[model samples]
Target: MNHGIEKKARIVGLFLFIGIVTGIFSIAPAIDSTNYLTEVNTNSNQVITAAIFQFTMSLIYLGIAILLYPIVKRYSQSLSIGFLSFRVIAVSLSIVGTILMLSILTLSENYVDVSSNNLLEIETLGNILKSSRDYANHVFMILALCTGNVMLYLVFIKSNLIPKWISFWGITGAVLSIVASGLVLFREIDIITVEYMVLNAPTAILELVLGIWLMLKGFDKRILKADEYENPDSCTLGTIHNG
Candidate 1:
């Protein structure tokens, strides 16, 4: 394996693991509850922690896209660019969701101090913020992520960067993720339900597996060597294979 590629692969894998862990923590149960507006003030610490985790996850998402672009672009520039674009969209939506979460927390703080005469208006605003956060975090953000994963897996399949089976699994998982997000967007299924969880399980599991695989095995050596030959001008410091 090329040392540079090996190092990059491991870094990507590490980012993936961190991103997944942070993503889970970002969904604080208190904030996700139906009575969040009433409860957020009491659970302010949890909400703040969740917001921090969410912002961290967004940074990881962008980092992964940037790191993979140079290598993936060698296989298919258009697909690589598509993957990067979708990742950026996902990150943007995730940041928006984080901001909405913090806004809700602020609203909750104000809720307790407001007079009863203003309670109804405050609750109404809270609900709107909650709904907007839901769409940003669950529906549109997930849709962009799944779309990016599809393009990424397609590149993997074409380039044999990873095993064919792993690529196929990623593609399948991405499709399932998209379906889950679509259902959420259409109001056919709510977030945090068993149905939504079941649909998203595959992609979640695939990412865990892929992260481990990349850390342990890196990209396929053959493909790295071949890509180096085909795109010498873009190649980083790596050994050339004649065989």
Candidate 2:
């Protein structure tokens, strides 16, 4: 029984759960992505609210990779690195975009007092920035779930480091999340639609539940023992390697 690895699993779960939870808060008030002008006028403080949430979420997103690396590397070193890499790009884009979002507040503030003659230019620039942030969200989401999460869940499914059912749920959730993100990206569906939420619910709930399970129950020892027989020195799966 690798108590060390057990502890790692719990920590990974904790971060994953918190990351998702914070992600929700980051986008709170559910500011409309498309209706920027209205959002600007109505939610004047939205920039501050969004920046706070995005920053918190970005840190947690990176934390998830750091926590999961050791547990995941035990199964496949390359795959673990791939997972971390995707997360890095995803989190970096999100953080940078968050900083850019700060400008929206200034833009919004100006919108309140600007001359009517410049309204067109101000609205255009504001919309452009809003669109860029939305695009970044779409790109990072696809990378994080499709590339990073897919690899992570696939490793778990193959190695039995976690329960097959939980792993399968993760895989399914990843697929569903990608589908949800795709619809938003392509304009087939809006960002804050019920259909979108329903599609993404699987992955969101998956992380929350899996995180709690890992934190509370730890890994199923029988499965971990089985994995130990297969890979004696790898930590969890890919990231942790004992000497």
Best by lDDT: 1
The weakest ten consecutive residues by lDDT in model 1 span: 234-243
Candidate 1's TM-score = 0.95
Q: What overall lDDT goes with each candidate model?
A: 0.90, 0.76
* Residue pairs with clashing backbones, model 2: 71-237, 72-237, 72-238, 73-237, 73-238, 73-239, 74-237, 74-238, 75-237, 75-238
**Which parts of model 2 are misplaced by more than 4 Å?**
28-30, 33-35, 41-46, 223-243
Compute the lDDT for candidate 1.
Answer: 0.90
Q: What TM-score, computed on C-alpha atoms, does each candidate reach? A: 0.95, 0.86
